[model samples]
Structures are given as structure tokens and as C-alpha cells.
Target: MSYYDVDAILTDAEKVPCQFELDVPYLGHLDNSAGLKPGTALSLPLWLAEMLALASAGEDARAPLTLNLPACLSEAVAAALKADPRAVALRDQSAHLYGVGVRMLDLFDERELGAVLRRTWAVRAADVGLHARKADEAVGGQGAEFLRGLEEWERALFRRGHEGVRRAREWMDRVKRS
Candidate 1:
């Protein structure tokens, strides 16, 4: 079975686009998007923005999007990462490590990174038993509950990131056979 089914788990999250004022022209087509003029602000999904930003940086070191995360979300991430320091500390930075996976998967379209993170997250989650739940609870039910409690935008971010990770894993499996 798959470790996560983002569509099933993230049904409650909305898709919020990130706004980017292009410093340089985006020459490629994005999801049938057209008329990408330089100096014009374009709104894109976070995953797309992240990928474009990285790709643009490589070509011109220009930032495609002016990204800003909310302060409360930052606090929530910090709190979640610090929730059980003793347990978290002994486990070798799993909290921050897990947070990184969540953040990267949420923001980017780097399949290799996602695949690596998928494996690392699985190993760490298993080591910590992070998903223990009653039979009545769905797999990752706790995470879903926690996600539901987040602010709308935060929930969206988490959902998007998880979907990225899932796609990455699927891509890896399809291409890695030798």
C-alpha cells in the first residue's frame, strides 16, 4: 500500500495560488497559461511557482516570485517541531527533518528530492511511530485532523506538499527499474 494518498487525505484543503511579479520573462507554458509578460505579476500554484523560481534562478539568478509565509504558520511549525523536545531530540532531529520534508514537498516539483524525502520520512516516521492510531482512525488520520485544525492557507500548503511527495514517489517507481 502507498504511504499516503494525498487526494483522499487532503480533500478539505483548497488550492491557493501564490503571486509572482516576474523579474525576467517566463518563456515556457504553464498549465495552458499564456501572455507572461516581464514585470507583470502572475499568480501560480505554490508548486509551480517553486519550480519556476528554481528554474529561473539557475538560468538568471532572478527570483520569479516574492514568497512570504505567514508569521502564525511559522510559529505553528516551530511549535510542532518543538512539541516533544526530549522525544524529538533523542530521535535525531526528526521534528525539523519532518518539517523540511513537509515544506519542500509543499513548495517544489523536484522529483528526486521528493523521492529521497519520501524514503527518509517513512524511515523516520516508522522509527518514531508517528502515526499510531486506533482501528477506527484512518491511516494518517491524526495528521488529517491536525491539518484540519490549521488555518486555511496552512492546510493548503500541507496538502500541496504531500501531493508533491506522492507524485515524486510514483515517478521514481516508474522510472527506476533497470
Candidate 2:
């Protein structure tokens, strides 16, 4: 989530469902209308939505908007991940699925959702490591399908694991040569 991280920037660009809590005439263009109306729902990028949802008019006033979990983190997707993290194509859901989930988790308190996300990451990470260890053998079979479904973080993990295995083999080869 660093400021300069490309993946973090993309994560902030992921859109989430939001509802305006108050009408603001100047921001109408956001919703393709003359003026933004109260109760108006729109899909807004995480950055804009977070700012709007957290900005209050006064000490006792409510924020301008309410943020909802993005479609990628919907209940159905959670259920699918819970059932089988490997089966769900997270990349298809969002290239930054976990990032959006983390931001939403900060906005809302949903213990179950957090647990599901954590479990999903754990399961898929182990699979990615296994595939990395046997990268050559996995390139053409079922492993390719799973690898293709990985999101940004998982892809990095796979690359690191694969590199580690390659380096270890190279060291072993050098030892044998000596």
C-alpha cells in the first residue's frame, strides 16, 4: 500500500458501490446528472469513495456518503473462496481483489469477511509455492490454470518461490561441478 507501488495505485482505482448521504450540486458530473442527489448510488473509485465517506460537514454531522463492499468481495464470492479458494479465479474478479478487500475491511467491521480473505490467501499461497517448486512440470497441466487465476500478490509470491527454487538448483549444480 505504499504511495509509489503500482499495484497499490491500481488498488485505489478499483471501484466500489457507494450511496450519497447528502446532495451536492457541484459534483453532479460524477453521476452523469444535473446534481448529485441524496440516496443516489454510484460506482466510485476507492480513493474518491473513501474521501467522501469519511468527510463530515461538522463535528456532529454524518459523512457525505456510505461505502459498500465492492462486487469482488460480495458474499457469493466469499462463499466460493471458502468452499475452494483454488477454484475461484481471483484475477477475473479484480487484479487487486485483496487490496479492495483490505480497504473495505478498514471501512467496515466484518470479522467473517476478514477470516474468509485470510483463509483464501493462505490456501492459494501454499498452492502457488508448490507450483513454483515444480514450475517446469506445472507449466502445461492443471497448475497453469491456477497460476493464471492469481492476483498481483500471489503472482509475486509465485515468482519469488520459483526464483528460490532455481537458485537452489544452481547452487547444487555448482557444488557437484567442484
Where does candidate 1 stray beyond 4 Å?
1-43, 57-61, 69-73, 84-100, 103-178
Candidate 1 lDDT over residue span 85-169, tens digit each = 2222312322223343455456545465455445543444442233222212454655555433333233344556556656777
Q: In terms of TM-score, how similar is model 2 to the real structure?
A: 0.96
- The CA lDDT of each predicted structure is 0.43, 0.92
Candidate 2, residues 1-178: lDDT per residue as tens digits?
4779999999999989999988789999987889988999999999999998999978999998999988999999999999999889999999999888888999899999999999999998998999999997658877778788999999999999999999999999999999
Q: TM-score of every model?
A: 0.32, 0.96
Which candidate has the top score in lDDT?
Answer: 2
Candidate 2 RMSD to the correct structure: 1.1
Model 2 has a clash total of 0
Model 1 CA lDDT for position 28? 39
Error of 2 at 164 (Å): 0.7
